[model samples]
Target: MDIGNRLKTVRQQAQLSQRELAKRSGVTNGFISQVEKNQVSPSIGSLKKLLDGLPMSLAEFFADAAESSSPVVYRLDDQPELGSADISYRLIGSHFPGRAISLLRETMAPGADTGPDLLSHAGQECGVVIQGRLRLTVGEQEFELGPGDGYYFDSTQAHRFVSIGEQELVLISANSPPTF
Candidate 1:
């Protein structure tokens, strides 16, 4: 793989400068510069440090590089799967063209949750519950949402969700800045 090009692309996509990335990754700016210029090959550990500055995992970085078709219809079965064992997300705009935002159909199994840790990212988010119930905590406020309930808020605030009902909960969620 073209590591230099990949690093450059990921950094640019993240809107991070070499200096900013260096500071965040705890590496020298010269090292980031060298890597981007293809002047040096970084060891896996070093590369991992760079990826950390992007605040993204290696799997996510590579996954975004896998090209997909544009301006096409994505059938239900064609949606990409995201998340882990407790939750599953179906990307809504997988085949849509010029998508400026991301949408998801997320399923949270009964008693499942995103953990106690709150997630904060740059974006605006909105969602509508489709089935069961969910407990949403945004910043210092918390709300219990039943089926057909909805919510909208800034994603920069720390937030988390939990399935509070006996059945699985499904939500249709949308986000600007494409956090997915």
Candidate 2:
């Protein structure tokens, strides 16, 4: 797929400049320019981060909106946005409105990390590692997990994720009040 062209189209549709998207995604403005110019191929994690800045999902980015016949539902909430490109999140219930929980199938590249800052938001989050290794940080505590391991924590506490092993990490995660 011509991802660069697609991103440019969506970004224009959203009425945002490259600088704006870079700021929102915690990426460099020059990187955004390179992506749009097809000069670089971003990793799955990087693409996920860019999509998150648009407040869009990987699924949404690739889906053909022309095929949809259903009405759109606009979500209203005062909660903060939470996510990391290090994990490509595949939302499971995009068609459902007023969903109380968000279910996702996440794939992280090897050595992927959730940037330099921890993330905190409303609600609770939990996930199980399905493959590879995961390094989870919650506030002052840190834990390393492998396949079949799981974790649950209050989302309000600062947390971060990192895929530590040589193989990509796969996780099934859920969040209450829909962190996305």
Candidate 3:
């Protein structure tokens, strides 16, 4: 993909000028201009910082780029798979235009975990356990949730999830600003 063009498209879709984006991203207007013009390549960290300013994740950016222009209905098989084999995340309504939230169907194999590093981002996340058991850790607190149990929290807090039961864990989750 043309990262420069993609960035420009997203930036325009968000209705942000390069100066505004630069200010939000803590980068220089010149840098943003150079990036949009394909005059320079940003390091991964730099690109991530830029994306963060858009309140977007790297995954979301890529997904948005690959998504169809407009899609209202998505079948199970049509959803894009993300993450790894142990913990699969299928995005729902991924092609919806101007989406304010991201919906996901997650399946976690027994002993599967999001990882040791907790996720912290710029939005809010909510999820409900559809089946099996989940161990959720937010900040310093931990909770073991079963089917029908739900959770809501600020995404800024470090959080992680793990499957605790022998059976596979299924969950439906949503996040504002569509992190992934």
Best by TM-score: 3
Q: Which residue runs does candidate 2 get wrong by more than 4 Å?
A: 1-86
Judge candidate 2 at residue 29 and give its lDDT: 87
In the range 8-52, model 2's lDDT, one tens digit per residue, is: 877876889999999999999899999989999999999999989
lDDT of 2 at 81: 29
Clashes of 1: 0
- Local distance difference test scores for all models: 0.87, 0.83, 0.91
Candidate order, lDDT descending: 3, 1, 2
- What are the candidates' C-alpha RMSDs? 9.2, 16.9, 10.2
Best-to-worst order by TM-score is 3, 1, 2
lDDT of 3 at 63: 88
Clash pairs for candidate 1:
none
lDDT of 1 by residue, 1-180 (tens): 677887887787678899999999999999988998899999988988899988978776566556423436667878889888989999976645336788899999999888889989999999999999999999999999998899999999999999997999999999998877
Q: Candidate 2 — worst ten consecutive residues by lDDT sum? A: 73-82
